[model samples]
Target chain A: MPAGTLYRGREGMWSWVAHRVTGVLIFFFLFVHVLDTALVRVSPEAYDEVVATYKTPIVALLEYGLVAAILFHALNGLRVIAVDFWSKGPRYQKQMLWTVVGIWVVLMAGSLYPVLGHAARELFGS
Target chain B: MSSDTTSATIGPVEGAQYDADNPAPYIEAPRKRTGKTPRATRGNFEMAAWLFMRLSGVVLVVLVLGHLLIQLFLDGGVSKIGFAFVAGRWASPFWQVWDLLMLWLAMLHGANGLRTVINDYAERANTRLWLKGLLYTATVFTILLGTLVIFTFDPNIR
Candidate 1:
């Protein structure tokens, strides 16, 4: 709310915001995931029927987004630990955040084929 | 040891509240600690929770990423996943333990994280309480359900 607050406009704040958003997203997904997986106890047919939805092109895209969220959260979480514990972490926090972003970009790019390849194949032609 | 002697260099300081011989009265400090306040009541639970976040986080980075790789990135990705795939994986004791540990750690970690968020943003006292109550309930239910599913899973239940 305050104008030009250090945390409000800076990398530290944005990374923290991203972390919370991604963490919440992942947490909710975990609930649904557990319930969905629990269907295996119901019946193989019932389980497969539900899992079929996950294989759809739309759901595959969502899965890609899920991967993005998870990767960011994991990487940034480590950065947060460094800022808390490392003796010189505060001095280099900005650099570490940029580093996290860099690795995230690379990993996200790499994941496209593996995570979205099936959907791409399905949407287009294998 | 030489309290009885006072030299000019060690003269009584300006507005000195008390000297060693005239000890101050025991006024209850603002954040008083007393024998009545048991250690268990004020233990480092929050500190433990904070430590758990970092520790479990380090482990989860491995467990969860590996899980994502296997489930969503390998062997044709989600297209290859189905009841049979899950059954095949769960058939092994190693995978079972991996999943069990992941389930417990991830659930607790997330629940605690959400608790922090709720405490930070929820304005009303009742709102925070309700949100946390719901969070804890869901966490417990999900963890127990996942655990039961893992242990009681019958691959032959086709």
Candidate 2:
């Protein structure tokens, strides 16, 4: 909304934006996660009760989304490092991003069964 | 090539011969700091933060991915996770240290990242101050709480 704030939109700028978005999402999730785990200090039932909510179909979808966010953040983070440390990183950042995306797609596809398979089974009665 | 105009115009200096082989000395931009500038104004905190992001990020890629693999992917997936699963993992000193390192590094890394975001987006000075205040408070609280949980966890606290 302000001048000098937006850069020329491209792979570089969009990746930066995605990185910020995912980082914020993951940070907020970490806050909740820490609080949830602290429930263990309260009682095993309390912790297990909360964790049960995580096994639901709706929450399974959210978990998948979380995985997507974390995976993107992690992979693109490596790309950011390359752009900083490697001599020719800047020159090949676009290529590296595509590579990151490629790997992300594979991992996400591989993760679907592990992450959401139980939810699918519960919903469909397998 | 306009010979008359070129001949009348003087180069950067009267008798200086600037060519590809020997270029003119570089000029410092306006407001650029010099040797005489105060050191306090040029503190290395931002640089350190920048470096910390990269270093912690590389390590987090390993730590977080491995964590996800163990918790979400292996052996019955999320269905297998519960108080008992966590108890089993945290029982080992190896996992305790792994989790401790992860909690610290990820918390600090995320906090510094959000600090940058706040500085960038919060327009007014007071707005930035208050946002960062809340951010720091939450960050410290979460870090302390998580660390306490990890260290003081009782496997048999039924």
Candidate 3:
């Protein structure tokens, strides 16, 4: 399928697309993460100043999105592997996808306190 | 000599019995075409990659989520995650290994996944090769630099 058709694809296909997109995003995050952490080696003052910036409302919101992406990608990635290697995995692929989705929903729900709570406080001071 | 020189032709896959509904007799199949399916270099590379993605993904879930929970949304949230915080965490070998494993697995998995994407979409062989070369170089540089910083980090350095 063409790149455009990827979004228009079925659930399994969309899962694949999500996996790839999330993987790429996380990769970029890691790239910056290393660079920023390396700043500690230069000077703790430099490191603290940069990391402190992430405490704002906007960055908190972005962090929430990052968590969502990583959660979905990680859960669906396991499903992908199951379908690839397990003997009956193909037969149960849809079920597995749903299961992953269910687990992801639960995990994200649990994380809401941390992700959105702080963001809301930072944004509205509540 | 001319009779002995046959063109490269593919025959139907073995055991494909004739069907009366599709009664057309088979001729020699078309020769290898540029757009034809590539040879199956069926190396363990792909199998290992597939396995590595899943395995690394599982580990990454734990390492990354824990790291985020600690560094971003815990104790005092991102405000608490600074040089001193990092130094404190890295003081423990557990945190150091966690960060190191997270770094290596995520980089390799992301690079490999992108490699598949490039192979799938980059039409020209040269484009594919060049793109992958660029990706590999970046991946290697980031991984090596990140690993060195993680291990050689001096916490007491003012």
Candidate 4:
């Protein structure tokens, strides 16, 4: 009941919160993605145009956000599964949370390499 | 209620022989004191949710795997999965239903799982409210849009 109590408000809880948030975001994105892909049936040109929109700066940034969401959701889900199933996992919950956060940062950075590289090249002559 | 009188009236008895063969009768405790009563004994909501998770999870496994197989492996693999291929697949009622089932199952399963996670984790009352609000919003939006697309997809353009 007191403020700032350890495990009163903990790391695992925040990880679970992020998981649900990301899962919902990814689910919504999936619907849009599936429908957009389905549009290929109507017209090839339309499909191409729709896909071309993804290449825009804003869309690319959104894609990066999606990638981060997916990574966090997946890694945290694994952490949840581990915690639920393993008896001794509670001891390592904070460790696992930090590990997930670290992995997400690394993966996101790696994934952004091409996008960032291209942006740099476009802005500054390479 | 006089606490001193109650204690004085009940003193500890001396040298009671333990009878291994004849045990004392076990009296049922009051319902409120026991705290073991089922919260929703009259309803089937919990049972239905449990069943839904298993059924939806089974269906999701198939739907997701089948989706991946078709999109990633069949025909010329990923390269052939262009606009025309997607349109061709959506042309059939079978594929539409397949997609619809996949959409519904995955959404519901994911939502239910997240609900469980939220209940297990979110401590603050306001935090839970805001998180669930966002979750329900996203889930409803996705499900509605997906259903609309499945039913209203048109293969032809003027």
DockQ comparison, 2 vs 4, better candidate: 2
C-alpha positional error of residue A3 in candidate 2 after TM-score superposition, expressed in Å: 4.5
Distance from true location, Cα of B130 in model 2, Å: 0.9
Candidate 4 local lDDT, B57-107, one digit each (tens):
556546765674575334533334445666689888899999988888888
For model 3, residues A1-126, the per-residue Cα lDDT tens digits are 555654435666778877878888888887887888888878888888888777777887788788888888878877887888899888787788889889989987887777667667766875
Q: What are the lDDT scores of the predictions, listed in order?
A: 0.91, 0.92, 0.80, 0.68
Question: Could you list the chain B TM-scores for each candidate?
Answer: 0.74, 0.78, 0.72, 0.71
- Candidate 1: fraction of native contacts reproduced: 0.92
> What is the C-alpha local distance difference test score of candidate 3?
0.80
Q: Report the number of the highest-DockQ candidate.
A: 2
List the candidate 4 regions with Cα displacement exceeding 4 Å.
Answer: A1-7, A114-126, B1-105, B113-158
Ranking by lDDT: 2, 1, 3, 4
Chain A superposition TM-score per model? 0.93, 0.96, 0.88, 0.84
lDDT of 2 at B133: 95
- The better candidate by lDDT, 3 or 4, is 3
Query: What i-RMS does every model get?
Result: 0.7, 0.6, 1.5, 6.1
In the range B1-158, model 1's lDDT, one tens digit per residue, is 46545454565653357753334555677867788877777679999999999999999999999999999998998988988899899989999999999999999999999999999889899999999999999999999999999999998985
Residue B80 local lDDT, model 3: 64
TM-score of 4: 0.54
Top TM-score: which candidate number? 2
Ranking by TM-score: 2, 1, 3, 4
